[model samples]
Target: MAGEMAAGLAEEGGSKIKMIVSYVDNLPNGSEEGLFYALDLGGTNFRVLRVQLAGKEKRVVKRESREVSIPPHLMSSNSSELFGFIASALTKFVADEGHNALFNDRQRELGFTFSFPVRQTSITSGTLIKWTKAFSIDDAVGEDVVAELQTAMEKQGLDMRVSALINDTVGTLAAGSYYDEDVVVGVILGTGSNAAYLEKASAIPKLEGDIPKSGKMIFEKLISGMYLGEIVRRVLLKITLQSSIFGNIDKTKLRTHFILRTPDISAMHHDGTPDLRIVAEKLADNLKITDTSLETRKMVVEICDIVTRRSARLAAAGIVGILRKIGRGNPGDKHKSVVAIDGGLYEHYTEFRQCLESTLTELLGEEASKSVTVKLTNDGSGLGAALIAAAHSQY
Candidate 1:
């Protein structure tokens, strides 16, 4: 069903035949030398990396990573402050290392994974559409983010270039496509949810003014980790009102934060439709005492299972929607489709992965299921950004 949904989405977009290509598949095969930098800004934290690509033989070519926590104030702060912090972090990263010949002359070139809805002007520039992931920054939408980062970097004497700006989904697609010709879509089922697929430039009606010769369109932030929290919040309001623990309990004081969504999912698993006493015990772990000597093991198992199932089924529905959109799952086509799956959810949760695949199979049919394989593509954001950096470089 997921495949059909994606295909349907493509058909709606006026695609004659849905063909989702991953950009990573297009990576140049050669022994090339280039210094690349990738900055990943997502929920909770941000990471900046400098990668040395030795092309095919050496691959990764070497990498360095640094993590910085996003300040609580920044989520609600003005753009200047937010960009300033990012600029300061990047400046610190550069100053941590001395002159390196490969990227010294062009220390200005870098790739940024903004992980939010931005009206991209090109591969290198975009405007912030709005803040998601519980972020409510005013006057942020329509602001040029790349320019903001650039101006801030200069103020800090940081000699770096934001040559490419991509969404995490696009990065995943790029990274997956680099290794597998069959990988067509990149999905992040982390704190939130989103998907990215390679689309033909000719198919985008929204961008009627200009057409790139490469014929590529990348959709980011439209669906990603930042919004899942909101989705959870919406679902919980309905569930709790109908369930036991919250049916009569006043929830007016419960802060509706993005983090609460995780617990909400856990709550739904424990009590959405009753028979949740055991699971509820787990959810109330802080409220109760779990005797390790007893059935504590069983409670944990049940809690994990139910929550994973709930998350997976909803995720499957989203995938199914996209598949139906693309015309890939319809009995009318025979081409195999591959989804490049990433993120903490699919990575850490075994039951969740199983449930997701099961739901997709139930929606798409056995034949299509055989043709559709959801494969994990790890750390695609970091690697894929580097790939984008390489592609945009003159070398």
Candidate 2:
């Protein structure tokens, strides 16, 4: 199903894949310098960073970062309140920087990494299409997210300019490309899943009038971390309804939505004990379903394996689809290329990563597989935003 989804997304008028356009075209070129700020608003926690870049000579001079978790009540609250909360956090983080030597008098330039779907109008502005990953803000939908953040900054009395608005996947690409020119793909496989790749403007039929000088598009919206855990939860729900293997514990835990999170399922799948003790313990601890037999534990692990395997295999297909779309994985193609990957799922889940690589090898075959590599690049989302800010700063 994921492979089908990916393929459909690649097609010009493909169904199922939304294939939304990101209006960003500026990419980092290693020459970006000076002080920049990054705000990564994705998932349950948002991260803020202050980076000191010294062009190509010293690269990153110094960095400081802080993470702030949103209370459940804030996610669905008024947009002004939520962004105001974020602005307050940013103000506190900046004030904490004090009169350090790295400090400059210039107003800060910020790259806002909004990880939801947006109809981008420019490099620095976009309208939020909708919220995903359990976020449902009615007012934020269709509003200019950049303007919202800017207004919040004003309320905080912060002297800053919003230089770039980007998706996390796009930030990953910018950061990865800064380090490796061969890196053409940026993927996030953490709590959610998404990919951003360089697409030729000519190939994108959805783009109208005045194509970018780079003639490229950042393709996101499929094969990412935000939906993987939910997919696993759905499959598990189906299995519990159909099977007696789970036994008669209060179906309460299983009935709860998103209760069986990806990390819990991953820990169980990685358990290698002869009796699968870790799986049993995790099930009992998370679901409160104790008194499980070894056979039942085995069955639970099998279900996890099945779900994650599909996710991994489909991720592989998405990568392959991008390669084929860009004319890389074809016969006689020999140039080496790298796909830079970030996010928790790809980094921590050993089984999922291995399955993804192996499946890629299987699909690309021996020859073409040798020309492609998926390299893990950590913290690209937050840091990439700063890099983009420096690259596209108005100052």
Location of the lowest summed lDDT over 10 successive residues in candidate 2: 211-220
Q: Write the per-residue lDDT of candidate 2 for residues 150-190, one digit (tens) a residue.
A: 99999999887889988888888888988887888888877
TM-score of 2: 0.83
**Backbone clashes, each candidate:** 39, 8
lDDT of 1 by residue, 120-206 (tens): 667766777667676777867878888888899999988778877887777887777666667777888775566777555554434
* All candidates: TM-score: 0.70, 0.83
Q: Once superposed on the true structure, which residue ranges of model 1 sit more than 4 Å away at CA?
A: 1-33, 70-78, 97-108, 132-141, 209-280, 283-311, 320-336
lDDT of 2 at 186: 87
Winning model by lDDT: 2
Instruction: Give me the runs in candidate 2 sitting further than 4 Å from their true place.
Output: 1-14, 69-77, 95-107, 131-140, 155-157, 209-243, 246-249, 288-291
